[model samples]
Target: MTHSTDSNQTLFERAKALIPGGVNSPVRAFRAVGGTPRFIQRAQGAYMWDANGRRYIDYIGSWGPMILGHGHPAVLEAVQKAALEGFSFGAPTEREVELAEEIIRHVPSMEMIRLVSSGTEAGMSAIRLARGATGRAKIIKFNGCYHGHADSLLVKAGSGLATFGHATSAGVPPEVVQHTLVLEYNDVAQLEEAFALHGKDVACVIMEPIAGNMNFVRAGVPFMRRARELCTQHGALLVIDEVMTGFRVALGGAQSLYAQQIPGFRPDLTVLGKVIGGGMPLAAFGGPRAIMEQLAPLGPVYQAGTLSGNPVATACGLATLREIARPGFYEALAARTRALTDGLTGAAQAAGVDFCADSEGGMFGFFLLPRLPQNYPEVLTTDGARFNRLFHGLLDGGVYIAPALYEAGFVSAAHSAQDVADTVALAREVFGKL
Candidate 1:
């Protein structure tokens, strides 16, 4: 098969003249890796076809929402059927209520929830709800765990912000993030210190239970325990941001995974997206009734979206969730992800390359280092130049991973054993060259 990107190059050239950086999202520009960003024409199962009609095994999975893969029959059918019913009511819909019920049934922490159009909206609203409920101003967030592009969240944020190396975006004013204290991802000591200093003033402590933006770093068990205790002791809420991990990690989200490790563990609030939207523009944040009722009609913390809980999006999300909830679905997905990491690790070891990989459920990431990094600063130690080479070599071999090393990759239920084998074979070829 030819690895031609002719049509992709031409489309990108045209896009650059119109769109900023020739992409709607920053990482999609391929600026970090210094290449022509492939203009994806379509995607199905575990494969994507670029504008040049070249096919590549897709690992990005639309950045994580395509856990059932591009166009799963169930999700597509639901979406199509809902579209025919009507697009948007600008009023309440029963399907939205059903989606909420589905989410509440799985996540124990949330007694009430409000659906929004994007992860950023969900995160931003959750912060507002936290501040409003607690009647406090300050909020603590971990450095590498990106909640979204919200002003408070962008402070020392990870993912696209880290890839660009911006301490904070220029457009956001200094006063906006002043109350936002940015701490290290797994530093329990710093967590303790922050609460000790401003315990009374802090409204909440928000973090990704498993930081995906920094390439799959698990918040240390000790650190997680300390965070939960500190938040409770300080009279502050613990908000777990699972926008990337939610249903993708498991039916119950990363919080459930943590619950298994620590007894009776759950966050005061939760933010969700990605898989819940099933590739559509939908996301949500929820918590117990007392805190959640603080938003809208019941209380003063106001948040609203014109297209919140969109009919078609909810249908897609609901279908995807139901399918994944089937017995053995997560077990199979986990095994497939583990197989990919194990294969790559063995190949890298055989080729004498310093490499380490980690996975949980369908999400995974790798670094060209002897071991996985625990935080943003440590994650930075990965050899960027070498990662670029491996990325390009994989791309040439018809396998597509994220353009930047900081981003996490996803494996879909649609990925067969043969697909894993093909990905591993491609990686071995790249490792041999390295």
Candidate 2:
């Protein structure tokens, strides 16, 4: 129960001397919250143990891949069996075909699929395929819907709607981002204007159905329906980046939810990662036969990776898919997620704190504002200092959440009712202090 700061601080200092920012990922550095990052030694079920040997209920879920929680028995068994067979062959494997078939079965829109190593690679390749298929140069992306750190995608909104975005990263040249048009999330009017101006030149309109990076902002149903229409009318692909929402949202994904609301609703292409990998390094992109066939040996849009469709990763994914496919899996997960959100909302109300939250399936996000935000600029209006205090208080209470407020949190099947209750109790304590 006792946590020693020396162990974490010493490890962090040693890591900073060697690795950039003392972490492989920038967010793990805890720079936003101003604290020594916890050096996670191991994770099991819904709990993670830091290097200081303190346990905390984990809500990050390895950023949305651990839907069944860490080391689910079925997934572990499949991974172990596959590792015994081989790691990478660089040619092809039956497991890859099976994984592809499994994915295609769930996602009907994708007649074909290609596995990759990371979400960034999958997204980047999807954009290239979009460009090659349409023979166009421009792509439309929203400001807060992160489609990985791909150069064209890593862009901020330009001076005006008519102007394209500017590069947000240092190494990415301005020319690389000039073709990318960044729009506001859930803005149908701006979307219509952009399409009217450059419909002929746009290759694809890519977006996350629910923007996760800027917290959880659902792309308005009206906005999504209009986006599909605009893409169809302009001969541009409607690409949905489901890297974070794919299986985490539902059996069919966020697309399935949209389809229920909008008749015949579906994207031309879908880019996916996270839960599909089952905590391994794997991602995929696919669409209809004619379009997806545009990539690799079949077509001119060449893409290759030595580690693509890795044997062990595919096994892990296949196992995960099988487990989640069982009856009542998603229903149970959704109910548990609702419980957590409602509990937190109640706790905040009791403490007289302004709070709002939203969730879909097992994915959730909360804000200190009185109501949920709809776009990147609105999301930024949250008081960072106040959220940081809440972050530290949760950490102190042994309930782990994302270090930054902009990121969405995940709940796993491994999360017990007790864990949710304890988390709310902790939050209530913290809210009182706030």
Question: Pick by lDDT: which candidate is best?
Answer: 1
Q: What are the candidates' C-alpha RMSDs?
A: 1.3, 3.1
Which stretches in model 1 have alpha-carbon errors above 4 Å?
1-5
User: Which tens-of-lDDT digit does each residue in 153-205 have in candidate 1?
Assistant: 78988888888888789999889889999999898888889998999999999
Q: State the local distance difference test value for candidate 2.
A: 0.91
Give the candidate number with the greatest TM-score: 1
Residues 117-233, candidate 2, lDDT per residue (tens digit)? 999899999999999999999999998778887788777621111011232666888899999999898999999999999999999999999888887899989999999999999
Q: Give the TM-score of candidate 1.
A: 0.98
* TM-score (C-alpha, index-matched) for candidate 2: 0.97
**What lDDT does model 1 reach?**
0.92
Residue 244, model 2: Cα distance from true site in angstroms: 0.4
Q: For candidate 1, give the lDDT of residue 359.
A: 93
